[model samples]
Target: MKKTLFCAATAAMAIVSSPAMAQEAGDIQLKVVGTFVSPDGGIEEVVVDGVGLPAGTDTAANDNFVPTIAVEYFVSKNFSIETIAGTTQHDVDAVSGLPAGTEVVSNALLLPATFTAKAHFDLGGVKPYVGAGGAYFIWLRDSAGGGIVPLGATDADLSNELGFVLQAGVDIPVNDSGFGVTLDAKRYFIDTTLQVRAGDTLVLETDHKLDPWVLSAGVSYRF
Candidate 1:
């Protein structure tokens, strides 16, 4: 009877300790995360007719929240490749000398797809990772305010951007199941061209930079 009890206890211990093992090579992880995006970095000056405008003459995009999905395929115990997809919308406001409470200069929709190569560190039941990759930004829709369209600016045209991405995150396994939680942050360096047009006549063209930081937290499942 004592030998049987010892065997049962050993089996229980193995079941409980299984999750502590690090993720092995050839594992696949999928995550559904909620993300909050905030635009950072200095705003560039808008130029008109060879004259630089005021420091705050550019438009500012508001912070936004969105849902994102990611898939990671591990090539080794410590190396993986991940891809993420998400879309966000932002309300643009004219800053600088613009009158107070006169916000809502325009609206912009952004669709970003990112691909990264990550290196994971195993520490007990927790896994921490850092990644670097590239991103492609599609400016789906950019519309100007009605009041500004007649001021020699009928429309706002934004070009698509290709940028670099930096990422860091941590994952905590829950129980011995393949379920976990993840917290992640990513920074994107994006630069694109903005064209102000009046009936096909280009009134102003300037380089616009939007370096945004995305923070996310959600559940993860490994297969």
Candidate 2:
């Protein structure tokens, strides 16, 4: 009876350890992502001279793109944590409605850091995952315009903002220690104030609602 009991216990242990071994072999992955932004909203009006008169100059929001680098660590076969660091650029108006047809462009760089909890599923050689997380965005730039102004106005008022992120993508295996590609998207629900006050008087004061969309595709590595 003792010999029979020992054999049964060993069989049960083998059955339990099989899945753990498979999970340990597929627990870590690293990915790189590139995101593109489409500027489909908002309009800006500009003045040609200091006459406080509208020169009928108008410009469209046409500049926004970001690059993201992330590392994903799998806690188990189906769950992981991912952190990302990247930079984004925002472009402003050129000259519109000018008699000589003057054009102006401005840009700003932003550092967006995010953390996410992800759930991964493997189907044969294909793995798909979905994630949700919080993001903190920092806008950095004083004056990033591409025009000449004698007044020398080069100061911007932007602050750090908070938002939520959601992503879903597929992973295709390459080799033993393989690489995969993913396409992901995110949106930020944010509103901030941008002001340009040269002196005690206000030149520009308005609230900007900056809700941006990111579409990206990148390669990933699994360990």
Candidate 3:
């Protein structure tokens, strides 16, 4: 699975760099963005219900900070396809006394490639835009060893997921090369889950849902 994700990512980059694709670059716009994001996790816990072990329970309110960068190619001045990539680290703290004093930290790489339909409103020095599109998420990782242990003691698995990206931003013209500063914010609506295997102990199983947010700011060069 890891190999396949890398290969797919490489192929996508290749296509973007190809001559034919380059020629289709049309309204090429490049931006470097800083994202302020929030991540929420839905976790399950294993408990002994006075007879045997009870099923996992669901919990939320897990939060974290993350950042990202985005590059977009305008199909027109108002329509575009953008690829936003970033990294996120989440720490799940200990709760109750069940698996108390345990922490699970998950570090993941995110690639959300989306197709957007936007309308740009040029307000002199500020070019603001609004858009919406579908996004694909790739390359995710989860790590343990904080204070909590996964049920089966397995690692984190984040398969590719399909979601939607909604965005709004403004561009400030800088120089003669159409170079400028840009501020953009976007939200990714994704339903993601983490799973752990039960090696020899039927005492624990790991599974949870994660839905995250993405925000950013950067420089832009329009040709």
Candidate 4:
């Protein structure tokens, strides 16, 4: 009778530890998503100018929708590292400074290079994750907006900056074959400096707050 009990316990342990029970250690997940980027273009403080900035000076960046792709590598069943590929474009407008609703930046294209480490929790078939990571915002191209051009602005340049992000998301598997749907959100703490020049003379310089909320929903395939 004791021998029978030992055999049963061994079999139970094997079943619990089998690869079929959960995601393996080296799983890779690819997610194709559509992302929404919204940024708060509030001027933190004017960095450089001949005269002082107007009181209550502020700005707002328009929202953008772009396509993004993410690749994730599982370090273990519960831990993973992820990187993303995408770019977004925005038009910054003056809200309180200058004329209200005036465009300060025509089209500023941005590339956010990101890498994150995530921890996941499996609740039934739903996997929820939280991640933290580093990001560098690269300004690909930009031009003077309508309002700035009339104000003697001949060229516009935004500085590249580094920042970090906090992330949260959920993955719901459609079936057991590594196909799923994912919903994710990330909040970035970052800022950039805008420099306006007219004939080599710095006409306006301002520090802008670009704290953007990135939201995404998409399909996931793990292998």
Candidate 5:
């Protein structure tokens, strides 16, 4: 997935770099990108009731690739406000206590709503930016995996949590027009709580660390 995104970014850069206008205040840029979401998920603590859980239980979240869109408004020639829209899905597996790898949560979908304020720097023709932002990870859906369902676990839910993010990226102009290619990466400092239930009984409740690295590459049009 990383190789594919790198190749796409290379292609975009090669196709777009010609002559381009400079950014200015009151500019609006729209970007469409292919994003890679990689979450470093793990169990922080387990609250067990009416079930048996191993002492050293831990977890890992599967990576996902999805399409993303962003809108940025230049507040100044060197500063902008940006936000993105996208959804990513992941599956969690118990990495230590259950087995070598045992599925615990299947099809957990999330909407990561974010906003960032960035400082852009001009290096000859290429523009590089550093941003600081806030994020809210909203869990849209989730279900118990096969490994947990057999243990009478019926449903699972991840808590909606608010966190912060750090970002860095570069934008390369494609032409004298408002066309460009962009490559971006953001690191999210966040966490979530997972609760599993069976009928009317709360079977398992665990806290998880959800710091995810979100990488993106694609084209941008500014006007």
Candidate 6:
């Protein structure tokens, strides 16, 4: 009877320690994420003709929604490299420092590409990760109106930006079919230059600091 009991215990241990219960090295994961970005920090003062504008001439960017896709290549059981792709649209407005009836609005389209190296921790069915990365932002077509437009502005342009990004996230595995759910957050440190023109004349040039925070949730699949 002791031999029978010992054999049963060993079988149970084998089942618990089976390779089917954990993720292994060389796994590839793909994720489809929905992201919301909120802008923070502040823009520099817009100066004109050697004179600076009022302190109230601050700019604020509207929150944006971005659909993102990412692919991760695991080099080891705990380390991976990931690349994310997405685009978003933001509207910029002069929120203060202007006349009571003055209005300012600018529409900007942005494309951001990012790559990160991550370390993941495995805890039973849950995995958590931390990453450090860099992002390259491409400024697409931008249009301005309201305060700056009426002041002889015919076009607006924003320079491309390169910045650092930090990320944290967790994944919860559902079932044994390699499907999971993920929650992620990232912060970006970015700065860009803005130029406004009126036909052949340059109207305004200024620097803007856009520190943005992104929150995301998504579905993931491992292959």
State the C-alpha lDDT per candidate.
Answer: 0.74, 0.56, 0.55, 0.85, 0.89, 0.74
Which one wins by TM-score: 1 or 4?
4
Error of 2 at 37 (Å): 2.8
Candidate 3 lDDT over residue span 21-112, tens digit each: 12133677777655566655556433222213224434343544455566677776556766666665555544444354355444555555
- In order of TM-score, best first, we have 5, 4, 6, 1, 2, 3
Clash count, one per candidate:
0, 2, 10, 0, 4, 1
RMSD, model 6, all Cα superposed? 10.4
Candidate 4 TM-score versus the reference: 0.88
Cα lDDT for residue 78, candidate 4:
96
| C-alpha lDDT of candidate 5 relative to the true structure | 0.89
State the displacement of the C-alpha of residue 109, model 2, in Å, after optimal TM-score superposition.
0.7
* Reference-based TM-score of each model: 0.83, 0.68, 0.67, 0.88, 0.93, 0.84
Q: Root-mean-square deviation of each candidate, in angstroms?
A: 9.6, 13.4, 10.7, 11.0, 1.9, 10.4
Which predicted model would earn the best TM-score?
Answer: 5
Worst 10 residues of 4 by lDDT: 12-21
Worst 10 residues of 1 by lDDT: 96-105
Q: Write the per-residue lDDT of candidate 6 for residues 14-125, one digit (tens) a residue.
A: 4433222356778999999888888742567464522245666777778887799989998888899999888888766766675633433466888877888899998665
Worst 10 residues of 2 by lDDT: 12-21
- lDDT for each residue of candidate 2 in 1-223, tens digit (9 for 90 to 100): 2343345334433333211223343467777866676542233323123424245544444545556787878787788888877787665553444333222335656677778888878765556678888888787763424442334444545557787877776555544445555555566565444455444444554344556666666676666
Residue pairs clashing, model 4:
none
TM-score of decoy 2: 0.68
Off by over 4 Å in 2: 1-26, 39-60, 64-66, 94-105, 144-154
lDDT string for model 1 (1-223, tens) is 2354345334433444446535788999999988889874224645543223444555567889899999999999899999988888876565654443233236778888799999999876668899999999898888765545556577777779899999997777776667777778899998767677777777766666688998887778887
Deviation of model 6 at 62, angstroms: 0.2
